[model samples]
Target: MSEWTVHGSRTIYTSPWVELDLVDVEPPGHPRYEHHLVKWAPVAATVLLNDRDEVLLMWRHRFATQTWNWEIPSGIVEAGEDLTVAAAREVLEETGYQIDPRRLVPLAYNQPIGGMSNAEHHVFLGRDAVHVTEPVDAHEADRIEWIPLDRIHEMIDRREIVAGVAVTGLLQLLARRCAY
Candidate 1:
């Protein structure tokens, strides 16, 4: 068995969303190596489907890439809160659509290979969604629309919705439907 020892570690940066730590480690019979690790909060997202089988999506401009993309409502899981509750809250806050918490389903957990952050995304099929208010986080999204399930593949292929969580949630939904 190979053994590894952590030589040292230092904080590179800290932010509300994430913290970066740089560490030096040595593997058995190998030279020292450096690794940059990111610690992030757990995040949750939802796929809100209405009675018509349309999925609610938000059109937002991601400043990191300076491009607009379609995405589902998602947010960080607050301390001492349940992931299902957070998923329901995100859908309501981001899309102004309220859904029954009982309908929230376990979709999938994802970890972006580029980062160490792992976010558990819960997707749900909302069969009775009603628009009751405007989006709470106006700065996060410019517009919101309901897209048919059939067009999701085309949107993904066209480079419209590139968010990892959104893609995984939608694909899980499709897979579940196919299994039925």
Candidate 2:
């Protein structure tokens, strides 16, 4: 398939977390038209696994979805922030787990809503994590727990772990584990 030509884009809304834009575009074999584009700042997330075959996760309710689910430590990366550093920082801010940024390895990257949005997710795997303090973003989650990694598949099947980035990271880790 050929790429659609973007003639111009105009911002309809702007916020620190997200933006709405209207773009004039022309498809390869179609007429030109204005399309809605949803945009978000780059997001970074980390799946923190320990030697005990457990993964750090947060139980939280997403207001937009109005559903409770388990999620890995994740947040929007600040403007000009390094993705790896943002991943580590999110872990500490959300779960109070301090992870060495240098120890974080890229695990997965996805534009989950590519059809109408430019939301980028960068997932990292951090195996070396230490609890340093209570969660700084306490309101972000109802509970923070170390969940058995083996139960992840079941949790996901039960709709407990449903965040796209979290699912992507955890599944990628599981896939990697089985590969080795």
Candidate 3:
């Protein structure tokens, strides 16, 4: 199949986290028209492990989804910020678990929404973490805890870890047993 041809794009709105664009495009064997395109900031997240082989997780309430779930530390990568550094920053800010940026190794990369959005995710694996301070972003999660890696599948099966990025990171860790 041929690639979609983009003639032009007009920004409808934009913010630090998201942008709305109307792109003039022609898909193969289709009519050319303006399509709504969503542009999102790339996200970075980490599935961190402790010496006991437990995974660090947070019990969070997502207001938009109106659901409570367990998730790994994650946040939008800032402009010009290092992806690994950003993942480490999120770990500390959201969970109070300080991790060496260098220790974070890439585990998975995915563009969650490709047809209508430029949303992307980078998931990392961290073999070590240290708690140096209380969480700086107190509003991020209500509870932070270490979960046994063996229980991840149960939690996921029960929909406890429903966030796509979080699920992706955890599943990759389980599938590959990635040691870094």
Candidate 4:
């Protein structure tokens, strides 16, 4: 397989969170094709731990998938916002934890769906997260809890921690633990 060249692109739809584009592309040895591309704003997700060493997580039921799972606090990084700031803001808004932006350490990055979407996820680790208030976002989560580290694998095996970014963040933390 060879790289596809985009001759041109036009926005098909635009929203606050996403933009869809129709791109004219030419693949090697093939005629021109119009491909539908979805552009998602960059995302920032955080693995937050309290002083007690328990990881903070949101438990929610996703209507899209009809499943309840544990997830990290995450949100889109607004244009021109620093990734660390976005991570801290998300955690604060979604989980009511005010994490110091300076303490938010980059952990990993990934493209959940690389084929037709341009959504890059930035994951961070926030240690000693402090609770400042109740969740400010009305629709943030069904519940928030601090789960012990040893129970993380149990939750994963039970399919209770299902969000891709959340899973990736925890895996990175677990890997780093092994390294030390």
Candidate 5:
């Protein structure tokens, strides 16, 4: 077993989305060290598909990266809530599409290892959805549009949507399709 010691920790920043912390610790057989850690809230996302095989996507401006990117409807999972429930809620809040929990197909989970913290993302595929209203999360996304499934590869190759979660979810969906 590895030895661990936490000397101290401090919050570097805090937002509704995430909190960053700097922690001083000692690792096994190593000198004392400090690492800037991100304490992120759990997030849930959905790959919603319609009868026409179109994927629901949102165009948003990521202020941290200063880039406009295409992403699926997603949000921070509330504490004590089931991941699937969170996914359904996020889709409805972000894209105005309410989907049954049973319709959600588990796709993948992502923990961006390159990042300082472990932010687990639960991704699901929402099959056969019907639009009910317009997006309401003004701060989260600018526009919600349905992109044809067949064109996703071209968009990815062109670097139109570069979010890791979106890419992973799309690839998982593709793999599932190819397996049939």
Candidate 6:
């Protein structure tokens, strides 16, 4: 059992994308405290690798953070949608690449911000992706490229790849490749 207990929770706001709540929690040695909590649909991220040993990346500006960085294609898994299907659909919509759902290998999952949010990100490694069309979402990326896998660590060291999901996904793929 956890050392803390949630006594009650009240919804502060609700939207199609996210929900916020105020939770009353009691810890072992402290009085009850109210914590702000956020709930969101789980996300699926794909590390798409082409035959040239390059990984697909999107370069875009995140308004919230006011920083431009490289990120993997990812999106929320809609209700009633299969995880793999959702990941492939996100890749197609964001990068104009059609990837076989079967080629999506589960890599790892993470909760990037457990203190304030209850959202899980499922990461996958996809291979054999083919360009089908331009990105359907105009804001998906300012530019897309297939960057050499060998330079991922260098990019990370240069702080060009900053998104948590993308960094974790790529590192997992790199680790797995080295293990083989």
Candidate 6 ranges with C-alpha deviation above 4 Å: none
Once superposed on the true structure, which residue ranges of model 3 sit more than 4 Å away at CA? 178-180
For model 5, how does the per-residue alpha-carbon lDDT over 65-94 read when each residue is reduced to its tens digit?
888889987778887888889999888778
For residues 1-180, could you state the per-residue lDDT of candidate 2 as single tens digits? Answer: 999999999999998778899999999999999999999999999989898989999999999999999999999999988899999999999888899988888899999999999999999989879899999899999999999989999999999999999999999999998542
How does each model score on TM-score? 0.87, 0.96, 0.96, 0.94, 0.86, 0.96
Over 4 Å off in model 4, which ranges? 178-180
| Per-residue accuracy of model 1 over 1-180 as CA lDDT, tens digit each | 676788898888998777788879787888898877777677878887765778889999999998889998888888887888888888888878887777776777777554443334455445577788987877778889989988998998998999988898887887786542
Model 2 Cα displacement at 81 (Å)? Answer: 1.2
Total clashes, candidate 5? 0
Model 6, span 66-105: residue lDDT tens: 9899999999999999999999999999999999888688
Please give the lDDT score for candidate 6.
0.92
**Model 6 / residue 37 / CA error / Å:** 0.8
Q: List residue ranges in candidate 1 displaced over 4 A.
A: 1-8, 27-29, 114-126
* Residues 25-133, model 4: lDDT tens digits: 9999989989999999999999987666689999998999999999999999999999999999999999888989998788889999998999899999888777789
**Per-candidate clashes, comma-separated:** 0, 0, 0, 0, 0, 0
Give the TM-score comparing model 6 with the true structure, all chains together: 0.96
Candidate 5 residue 75 C-alpha distance from true site, Å: 0.8
Cα lDDT, model 4, residue 165: 98
- Candidates in order have lDDT scores of 0.79, 0.92, 0.92, 0.90, 0.83, 0.92
Alpha-carbon RMSD, candidate 1: 2.4
- Give the TM-score comparing model 4 with the true structure, all chains together: 0.94
Model 5: how large is the Cα RMSD against the reference? Answer: 2.4
Compute the lDDT of residue 64 as modeled in candidate 3: 98
lDDT of 3 by residue, 27-146 (tens): 999999999999988999999987787999999999999999999999999999999999999999998888999978899999888989989999999876889899999999999999
